[model samples]
Target: MVVGAGLAGVRSVEALRAHGFGGAITLIGEEPHRPYDRPPLSKAVLLGEIDSTVVDSDLGALAVDHRPGVAAKGLRAGVLETTEGELAYDALVIATGASPIRLRGEGPQHVLRTIDDALGLRALLRQGRRVAVVGAGWIGAEVATAARRAGCEVTVVEAAECPLAAALGPVGAHTAPWYERAGIDLRTGAMVASVDLGGLTLVDGSTVEADVVVTGVGVRPSVDWLAGSGIELDDGVVTDEHLRTALPGVVAVGDCAAWWSRRYGRRLRVEHWDTALNSPEVAAATLLGGPGEGAVYDPVPYFWSEQFGHMVQYAGHHAGARLVMRGDPVGTRWSACWVTDGGTLAAVLAVNLPRDLMQGRRLIEGGQHLDVDRLADPAVALRDC
Candidate 1:
């Protein structure tokens, strides 16, 4: 049984079937709608380029019982409690993704996590409308981009010193100018005191009026239901390299699972679409083959975004790694490589440079040692570096 309906949950079902699991499969979701793609909610869906992001999966042909609008309340030995009633499963896949971190506001603040959120925010983004976005993360930047395209006067208030501070760290400052170039009022080191119907009040006792306010600070793993279920939880549901929990016959995946990464020598809980798409196969294999009997769940984390007239892509983990630039940051196309002290590629960030991103991703996965001087040269290919 699967206890979610997002990309991870749906993919888990497909993986189980692909692994020849002919047992009864049941899928449950808290939302009334069927499983849908979420990355588009911030871009194409908000821009009205697409009406829906529902995934094209036929559960009927797969002979799976899909139950929507049923939320998991609790879990116990051999029993899964839901809003409706209790159910039993021989094995379980927990894919309850994550929830957006909301700020302390009273008025109608917008968020871009669900389809309804994008559609609702899209309605408010009109010509001459005032939009104030909190947090300069990926979601915030994408929303600002879409609002600017819709002719809204957008003001992005970020508490950090630069955009993507949490994701890219100090290196994010290099991309700060892009906000101003796009005509967005990018206010760095600005803290919000409160948010109301009129708009948000800064800590400095100033007001930024707006017709709509969005909080894209970040998201937290959705694991409240597993609190007393004997499943360990730290940043998320703690899992081994096989994505298996402490208890047998159960595993977690997607944003909720903090699986151990043998490559990075750490536990990583990546909240990206790539993880949700690829991790399920390893999870299914582990479930069918038992612990440590099949493919492991280690992977090079990856994500991409389209904002401010640029296609940004990143692969691998960059924490505690040195940044190596391939080209000028001011240029139209460039790539940033993160290398370890041992001269191994740890991660890569490419902007409008697909070849660099593709090649750098391969090098990282292959655990190839890179020459620092060659990697810093734009003329040098990532494979050669």
Candidate 2:
């Protein structure tokens, strides 16, 4: 039985069947619709370039019982409690994903997590509408970009000193100017005091008028339903290297699962789409007692964001990495590399540089180290480095 029906849940089902799991597979989803690509919710979907119904894959002929529009109330020993009824399962996959952190305001605050959210926000993004976006993270950045594209006067508020502060360190401050170039009012070190239908109040007693307010602060794992289930929970459902919980017959994946990554030597809870896609394969293998049974769930986390007409791609984590620049950030195209103290490639953030992004992913995955001077030289080919 799979609990989420999101990317991880649906992928787990497909992987199970692919791995020759002949047992009865039941997929449960809280949303009425089947699993769909969520990253596009902030990009093409919001821009009306594509339909909101971005289903990841067709599940027809997959021979699985798909239950949508039902909420999982709780979990018990060897049983799943839902709004409909209890489901008995020999083994279960928990992939409930994560929920956006809502702002403390009375206004029409929005978050881009599901199809419904993107539709609602897109509808309100009329020309010249004052849209105040709180939190200058990836979601906020994308929303601001979309609003600007839709001719809305967008203002982005962030409590951090710079945008993407948590995700990108020294590179974040350099990237902040992109918002201004897109005609967005990028205000860092700004905190939201309150939000109303009229606008929002900042901690500095400044008032910004807005027709819509979107919060992209952060997200927490949707593990409240797992309460009393005896599953360990920190920031997310704690799992071993195999993406298995303390419970023997149960495993967790996706945003809700903080699996131990042997490569990073830490427990990571990645909310990106890549993690959702890859972890399920390992989880499925673990469930069927097959290829990935004893395999570790360490992966080089990859994520990309499209904003301000620049495609930003990042691979790997930047924890304690030595910052290195490949090109001028003030230019139209550049890339940044985060190297470990041991001189190995830890992560790479490239702006409109596809070659750097691709090669950086390979280098990080291969645990390759190169000469710092040569790596930073744009004229030097990445393969040569």
Candidate 3:
């Protein structure tokens, strides 16, 4: 049995079948619609470039008993409690994913998460509409981009000095200018006091009048249902290197699972499409072969964002790593590499440099040591570095 109809949940079901699990497979979700891709909700879906983001996988051909709109209320030993009733399972995969963090505000505030959210926001993004977006993270930037494309006057609010401060730290300063170049009103170090239909007022009493307000302030793991269910929960559902929970016969994956990473020597709960798409296979192997029987679930995390007419791609974890620049940040194309004190490549961020990302990802996965000077040279290849 699998809970969650998001990418992680659906992929979990597919992984189980691919591993030869022929028993009764039941998939449950809280949303009424079938499993769909989420990354497009902020881009193509909002731009009306695509009507539906539903995944192309055929549940019927896979023999999956998909039950949409049925949410799991609780869990127990070999039994799952839902809004409908309790169901038994030999093995379970928890992929409940995460929910967006909403701000304290009144009136209609938009958030880009579900398909309905995309379409609803799409309607409000007219030529003369004023759109105020809170938070300067990836989602916020994407929302601003879509609104600008729709001819809406966009204003992005950020409490920090630069966008993506939490994720990229000082490296985010490079992106601050991109917002201005795109004609967005990028206000940094401005705290939002309150949000209403008219607009949002900052702590300084300054106001940003807008017809639509969207919040993109990250998400928290949807593990509240697992409370008192004997499953460990910290930042997310705590899991071992094998993605197994404290209880036997059960494992977690995707955004909800903070699996131990042997490479980084920490527990990481990556809330991105890459983790949801890849981690399920490892969880399925652990379930089929029993605990401690399959390969460890540790991979170089990868994610990308398209905004301001540039493709930004990042790979690996960059905490506590020294930054190495391949080219000028103000340039149209460049790459940033993070190297550990041990001279090993830790992470890489590429801006309109796909080849650099591809090579850097391979180097990061192989744990290769790189010469700092060579890495800083734009003319040199990542593999040679």
Candidate 4:
């Protein structure tokens, strides 16, 4: 039984069938619609450049019993309780995904977690509308982009001094000027004290009149349904290297699952689409191959975003790694690499430089040693290093 109708759940079903699993499969989804992509919701969908249909895909031939618009209430032992009925599964895969964190005292506060959210926000983003976006992370940045495109006066309110502080560190703040260049009011170190229909009130006793307010603080794993399931839960569902939970015959994957990565020697829970698409194959292999030969769920985490006229791509992890610049951050195209003291590549970020990310991802995944000088020199080919 697969619980979730999102990318991870659908991909898990496809992987299982491709691996020749002839057993009966049941896919349960809380959403009424079929599985669809989510990345475009913040980009093309919000800008009205494309509709939600762009992310829709047909999963009719998967030969699985797909139940849409049904909610899973709980899980205990081998029985799964849901809005439909209780289901007994020999093996269960949890792929419930994550939920976006919302703001308090919300009057017109919104989050871009579903198709309805994008559509609702898009409808309110008429020309001359004042849009206040709280949080300067990926979602906030993208929403600001779409709002500006719709001719709305956009103001981004960020609690941190820099954007993407938690993810990209100091380098992230460098992109802040792009907001000004695009005529957006980017307010840093600003805390939102209250949000009402009239507008937003900052901690500094200032008010920004806004027709619509969007919050993009962050998201938490959707694991509350498994509270009494006896499966370990930390930041996410704790799983072994094979994506198996503490409970036997139960496994977790995608955003809600944190598996120990043997390559990095740490537990990681990635909420990106790449993790959702890539991890399911390994999970399916492990589910069918059993304990003796199950494949390990270790992958190079990757993500990309389109904002402020720049295409950004990042791979691997940067925690505890030293930063190495490949090109000038002030330029239109540049790349940054994170190297460990032990000489192995840790992570890479490319801004408008696709080749750097394409090659740097391999080096990081392969744990390749870098000649710091060659990597710093943009003229040198990344493949040669």
lDDT values for all models = 0.91, 0.89, 0.92, 0.89
Question: Where does candidate 1 stray beyond 4 Å?
Answer: 290-292
State residue 255's C-alpha deviation in candidate 1, in Å.
0.8
Clashing pairs for model 1 are none
Q: After the best TM-score superposition of candidate 4, give how far the Cα of residue 266 lies from its true spot, in angstroms.
A: 1.1
Candidate 4: stretches off by over 4 Å? 53-58, 290-292
lDDT by residue (tens digit), candidate 3, 1-385: 9999999999999998888888999999999999999999998988879979999899998899999999999988989999999999899999999999887768567888889888888988899789999999999999999999999999999999999999898888899888998889999999998887698988999889988999998999999998888999999999999999988989999999999999899999999999999999999999999543676998999999988888999999999999998999999899999999999999999999999999999999998888999899999999998
lDDT of 2: 0.89
Global lDDT of model 4: 0.89
Clashes of each: 0, 0, 0, 0
Q: How far is candidate 2 from the true structure (C-alpha RMSD, Å)?
A: 1.1
TM-scores of the models, in the order given: 0.98, 0.98, 0.98, 0.97
Q: 3 or 4, which is superior by lDDT?
A: 3
lDDT of 3: 0.92
RMSD of each: 1.2, 1.1, 1.2, 1.5
TM-score of 2: 0.98
For candidate 4, the TM-score is: 0.97
Tens-digit lDDT string for candidate 4 (157-221): 99998998878999898789888888999999999988877789898999889989999999999
